[model samples]
Target: MSTITTIGFDADDTLWQNEQFFRQTEKHFATLLAEHAGGHDIEARLLEAERRNLAHYGFGIKGFTLSMIETALELSGGKVPPNVIREILDVGREMLSHPVETLPHVRETLEELAGAYRLVLITKGDLFDQERKLAQSGLGELFDAVEIVSDKTAATYQRIFTCHGDGPGRSMMVGNSLKSDVVPAIQAGGWGVYVPHDLTWVLEHADEPTAAPRFRRLEHLGELSALIERLGREG
Candidate 1:
């Protein structure tokens, strides 16, 4: 086994619950749209709106707002009320103001890892929202590099490797998201360590946990030191 060097992290649900808030807000928005937008099916419209927004706004609250507006107009058959936009924007901004609570053992694990490996945050979302969370978390200095992306795919990880000049031998990814953190990180030639969260989104699921040497997992960040020690001893 190769000794790991750089350690990458995923933001959002990995650090603290993020998707739950989005899910909540979406439900609220859907209800509002149903009433105001004239009986439009909330779930279907939301999916359509998200698909359209992904193409137009990429990812972020700005695009979300746009999608809300588009959905209202389309569903209402051009009967969108002015206040509808305000309501959605208010929700989006509220998302910005959402409380910042770090995950359990996150700080301690980070403190430990900081001494052993170069830390970087690689997350995908609206640039503005992601940046705000990063700033508010007060975790900026802990990460040697910070990457805000629109999406994380197999290609995204490899690109991150190139961007940061980190090869598999010297790099690892420790995060809660398996889809975004585990598979892509390994496919990109970096080791991945998953930390399962009590509350997590469904989108990050993987078919199965990646196997040893290339992949590892911990229930909490507290176990990180031991995992690293085991890997080190094997190497």
Candidate 2:
């Protein structure tokens, strides 16, 4: 409620339909390896592979596709057919080409807030894929600035908010991930708003921010305007 002036948003589940595509791709991948391993077993191995590959390839479709391939190879003991590899690549291509569907009330909420505050897109992912999503989303112009970073941390939030000339105290971050968007933002001295998504990547999970006075939780993006208005009044 400290007269929040600059607002930041995470792009993936907060604004658009991202995780669904990945989930679909993962399902298809598991089916392809059904002969080699059980669907659930393949899924478990894929998750482990993705976690292990994070440090090496970072995030996004490219890294995920590679992990799926590696998992397939491991599950099949290197006997996986060439055709299966081609299908895996095809799944990645399908994911990359999936339409960017904005979540309910995202545009309306952004439109309401755009004129009153400095709005920034503070998402972390691969450069090319993130950029592609931004371009496809058609909501890019609503953001005053866009940041497609490699990672999200307290220091990262502090630096971004500070560079925006507002510092973290007067800034706020809204998104679905408690780990990447809320906790780090609050730790950096900014207000953090959680807009829960129906689907979240396992790696992005974190405990709710009950200890932070500036933390706010909303059911959806549409409620953001009212929350901000109330915070402003409190300020």
- Best prediction by TM-score: 2
Query: Model 2: how far is 221 from its true place, Å?
Result: 0.5
Candidate 2, which segments miss by more than 4 Å at Cα? none
TM-score of each: 0.86, 0.98
Error of 2 at 57 (Å): 0.6
Off by over 4 Å in 1: 36-40, 162-166, 198-205, 209-213
Candidate that scores best on lDDT: 2
Per-model root-mean-square deviation over C-alphas: 2.7, 0.9
Per-candidate clashes, comma-separated: 1, 0
How would you encode candidate 1's per-residue C-alpha lDDT over 113-220 as one tens digit per residue?
885677889987778788888888878888878999878876777777666745755677778877778877787777888888766554457764545448887878
